[model samples]
Target: MASVSMKDVALAAGVSQPAVSYAYNRPSKLSQAQREHILEVAASLGYPGPNVLGRSLRSGKIGAIGLMMMDKLSLAFADPCTIALLRGISEVGELENVALTLFPLNNNRLVGRSPAANHGSLALRGLVDGLIISTLPDDHPAVLAVVKQNIPFVVIDSPLVDDSFFVGIDDRGAARTQMQHLLDLGHRKIGVIIDRLNPDGYRGPIDPQRFKSASERIVRERLTGYVEAASAAGLAFEDLSIIEAGGLDSTSGQAAAFTLLTSNDVTAVVACSDVMAIACMKTAHALNRNVPQTLSVIGFDDIPEAVQLGLTTIGQPMVEKGVYAARMLTEQLNAPAGTRLEPEQKIFATKLIVRTSTLKI
Candidate 1:
């Protein structure tokens, strides 16, 4: 039996080889009827279409982008904030009619545990045209792998390493504003619930050096902003009373709230995210503490639930961030190498959404 080829398909379909290739690789180049006819003929002839690897090599485009996340795919899907960003990315993808491939990092390894550990292998595998990585640490091993591969990539809510493209809010400034809202309300005893600083996922006292080393860009920036705001208002860092949450969710927020609210000296709680802040509210209610009167609370990221709960927070454009990231990656994939996009660091502004969650003391 003779093997089927593009030439064979073209000859049978009554079209040129280039036309057959166009029907498979560049579908838009052919009329809809022509493309359908070619596909139908190829399918009847048992041709499986063109080789993707060969097409990629010839066109220098994969028509797809990689979206990398730190946590499991299930967790990423569960988070509303992450979902919004993903929706934004999907919108752009829909417009371009390209697919987004999810590359999961094997969590079984000890030394190479994180998604960063396997980034090099994934990037070198030539599965994606570019990468859009969402993680805490900008210098994570997986991120470095993307860099080593020299693949066009973008970072979202991570540190700026080597002037790569990024889409995020002003972490330090937003944190400062959020904390200052509590300060202005005369809530002196403020407590903070922060996500883990290190990739090892330790939940305890944050050592300065280790925090510096393991901290993602957003975490460090927001912490700095909170610290700065506290200092400016004459509140000592020691008095800030920080609790490190194992993860960024309601459960961790509630646990942190339980610990902080139990203290008679604590009057206000500042959560890093709306999910945590709302969790703190639920915990406070369980503890019989009246919100805004006995304990004022503030959260960041004005997710949908935040507004309903009247939770005061800093509103970062989550959807826009995702959209911008997708746009940036697409642009990088389309652009020539060595040419940087305009405004490499796309920083979105945040606003303080004052609601019923906080009150003047």
Candidate 2:
């Protein structure tokens, strides 16, 4: 049997070869109706469209985007916040018929090579048209490699770089607002549980310098916001009890909550994420402490579980951030050469979602 070609599909559809190519490679170049007709005709003729690999080589454009996260791919799928953001990105990618690939950092099992190193090499080699980086680490090797390659990309939930696009919330302000809710509830002694402060993943008692040099911008900024809010309420920064969770999971949350609950000074706990807040609530239950009545708890991200648990939280537009980030990458890819693809840094507002977890003393 003979294989189908662009010309065959074009002739069958009564369109030019370029029109057929535009239907698959650059749908934006043709009118919606025309593109739909070309696609339908090509499909009817059993033409699976152009070979992505061959088309990419010919046109210098790949219909795919990469999303790089600091954590493992499994964890990314498990986290509600990450999942929401991914769903948003997926929606945009679906519209453009673009594949969104997950790139993990530090694949420890791949001999001596790191996943970050591998992903960086691929980015530099132009494996994907663009990238959406969701990690908070500023100096990540993967991030630096992408920047060095001069690929169009966007950073989500992280600090804005002059050369890259960013879509995120004001972490410090969001943290401050959430923490203030606890303070307003007459919770003078509040404890905080956070993920690691540095790339080294040190557990427990992060020093001032380590905090200052935190690779995760969100963590540093949120910590600063919490400190500022606590200070305004007459609480000294040093006086705020802090617990470093090894990771952003319920197990770590439980451990941090146990430590904080055992302390005599902490009457409230502010978890950096909803997962941790839920764990804290579980810990409170284990300790026979009534939430709000004994220990008020607040969280960030306002994941669905937070509302179910009646935990007060700071709600940021996670899905919207992902959508905007994906859209920015798409625009960069479609833009003309020498066109400044630098999208203005977009900061979504965060609102305080009050619930039953907090109450005035």
Candidate 3:
């Protein structure tokens, strides 16, 4: 059957096409009784009103924002850092009355071509008013798409681009501080675990060459900090046992921690994230190695679990970072059309939170 149209409703209600439009979009243009009568007639005729897409296209406003993340959408809810970040973004989004859309670029090696490679164009083609890019690796092809779209965007951590709004901490400095704490505790042999160096599926045991050329910005900086701290203590990148968790979840962390705890020689362990750090502690306990007694563990991103489990970690304000990134994008969006704002950078400070997970050897 043919769909109901505004013309059909107008004809049934003894009104012109413009009168029907005024009833729905410009109610004040018509008398209240006339508008109500038109609406009732339209409802009886099953006229669903104006095309939202058409209206949005004409107005040049979508009333929504896009978020491009490094991992799969499934991890959005699973990762504590992302959860806190989303909470902050959602708070501002509620006030701004804009919706949030996720465009997770699954960088992990898949059986076939990556889905991000397929749907990236859709995101860049005016799907949302603005975008927030979160922790993408260096030279990600998707970023080129975003730049080509000429859309308003804010980058949250990793892969610092020139002439762009960025919000993050000094990853290298924070990691150096984290490792220095472990070194001060008299730990010589240390194992380090990270989520991934790049989007590739490669996992387990980071070779020195890969360590020198880590592709992910945040990971590279943190690894550099660890290497620098170790070098100061008479160690090199090759001296430390570095393992890639292969993923961001606890299962991946547990696997990496197990391998590092069992295969390599180390008294202390530094994980790039609290999730992996907690996994290191769990693996140590399962192997009959007590935390801070037999094996010391340190983690980055002092998530809530770090406090509950008393895990020493490097703390960055995840929620605040998110809030700032959202605000930056919103600021760009709220500006007059075709007005380009100056690129801004906000580097938050990180602190080393000492907990019971580490010991003074």
Candidate 4:
């Protein structure tokens, strides 16, 4: 059967096509009763409203934004921090009547395609009015590619590129504060568990050379913070035990925790994330080590689970980070043509939430 068009709806409703268009697009142009009558008539004629493709072509906008992340789609949803951030973005998108398109840059389904190769293609071909890039590494191929495209974008964290709005906390300072808490508690022996230095899928102790080659900016800064805090306490950097979890999930974190706790005679552990810290706590339990009495653990990103688990952590405004990034991008996209928005860096504060996981000895 032939599809019903606005003209057909207008003819059946005894109204002009432009009047039908106003009923859908500019409802204020028609009275409530008139608009309702037109809609009812159109509905009876099986008209499903406007052609989104045609409207997009006419307005140069698809009424959508892209949310680019470094992890696969499944991992992104599983992550508590990412979920909270998404909630904030969704709130804004709801108010603006915009749609969200997720681009998982690390999705393996691309069939033998390298991240750079896929990112290059995606940057050139992806269709969205603007982008919200979260936690991609500095010098990532996608970052440069997106910048080159002259697309309006907001960066959540990492790679503070030129002409891009940025939103994040002081990672190094937050990490330092986290470590300082342990140090102030007089814990000399410390073990550090990190998600990964890079995306190489290597799970083991991180050496100085490997640490230097870290591609992820946030991870590198957090490690630096731990090192700085230890150094300030007159501890040697070489003596600090650093283990890479190789992944952000619980399994990798548990494996890294087991390795660190079993090999090192550490009195405390500092994890790069709450996930890792919770893993450390579990490992400590399995090893018959009591938290704060025999072992102390500190974590970053005070996720919801952290409270229930009593994990001491650095609390960042996760949802606020998302809300700020989305708002900034939307503002730029909604601006008048040729209006230049000065890209601003929004750095939120971090707090130390000392829970039952740490003890001074």
Clash number for every model? 1, 1, 0, 0
Models 1 onward score TM values of: 0.78, 0.80, 0.80, 0.81
Candidate 4 Cα errors over 4 Å, as ranges: 1-58, 93-96, 108-120
Cα miss at 316, model 3 (Å)?
0.5
Alpha carbon lDDT of residue 130, candidate 2? 79
Candidate 2 residue pairs that clash = 107-115
Residue-level lDDT tens digits of model 4 in 196-303: 889879999989899999999899999999999999999888788999999888888999999999999999999999999998898889999999799999999999
lDDT of each: 0.76, 0.77, 0.82, 0.83
Quality of model 3 by C-alpha lDDT: 0.82
Residue 42 in candidate 3, Cα distance off native in Å = 40
If both were scored by TM-score, which would come out higher, candidate 2 or candidate 4? Answer: 4
List ranges where model 1 is wrong by over 4 Å: 1-61, 93-96, 104-120, 205-214, 336-343
